[model samples]
Target: MGHQYGKKGEELVFWNSQKQAVVSNWIDVEDHKFEPPALELISELLTKPRNGLAPDLAVVAKAEAQLAKVLDVYEARLAEFKYLAADNYTIADVLHLPNLQALMETPAKKLIESRARVSAWCSEILARPAWAKVVEMKLKAHA
Candidate 1:
């Protein structure tokens, strides 16, 4: 990636060293935004209605069971949790951790524990520097 200046004091990504042909021009800066909302919302939603139905279980058991199967894809991925493309940490860990903890700490214990790889992966990622950064941030706030 390259950038060319147009007599102005702004940096732009230049494409093939030509004018207005930027492959990737970006303003680098700090972000004042919260966590990316969509991923955060899924993690939050996964926490509710363990059977994956609406808050009202008034629906039939078969309906609830069908909804619960939505987790199978994730559970299958847990079989490859050891290969999440990060050595021992990743943004995936951040996205999944909260909801995972909620599951493990609830009646869903056996369901979660049935997969050993998931447990190990979660523990390993939680022990990494990336996750530790969040822990430190929380500690500082409480202190």
Candidate 2:
């Protein structure tokens, strides 16, 4: 099994029979491959400077533009389906959980909430007990 400590000190591993590896610091894993927009978003967020420390407005704007493109794709798909992979929630939707939770608290939140379908989808996912439990554990750990 492939296992290691990620940059943020999170444990990363390849799980399941398919040997899916954890991607970035998000609680997402796939079978040695990533579906689009998810893979693209992960790469964009990881490569850019953290929100507050970005050197100038241009950098932030550029990042936002890139993120917008990805979000547009998500919004369009969500408009027709309950989840990214269709009606059933799958790894594709699971992969967005952590990142979306964080994004909901940031200025970019409007980018999601402004889109009706995306907002509804986020609400449904965030309300899941599994996600709630994860949030509880994270809060307690920080406390």
- Please give the clash total of every predicted structure, in order: 1, 0
Which window of 10 residues has the lowest lDDT sum in candidate 2? 22-31
- List the candidate 1 regions with Cα displacement exceeding 4 Å: 1-71, 84-90, 102-104
- Local error of candidate 2 at residue 125 (angstroms): 0.6
Q: What is the lDDT of candidate 1?
A: 0.41
Global CA lDDT computed for model 2: 0.59
Candidate 1 C-alpha lDDT tens digits along 1-143? 21233224323222333322211111110011112322233343444555574432333233324323433433565565452322333233445555444444443334345556655665665666755787788779999
lDDT of 1 at 78: 54
Candidate 2 regions exceeding 4 Å error are: 1-55
Question: What is the C-alpha local distance difference test score of each model?
Answer: 0.41, 0.59
Estimate the Cα RMSD of every predicted model relative to the unseen true structure.
11.7, 8.5
User: lDDT tens string, model 2, 19-129?
Assistant: 232122222322222224333443344434454333345544565676677667667877777766546555556667777776665566777788888789889999989
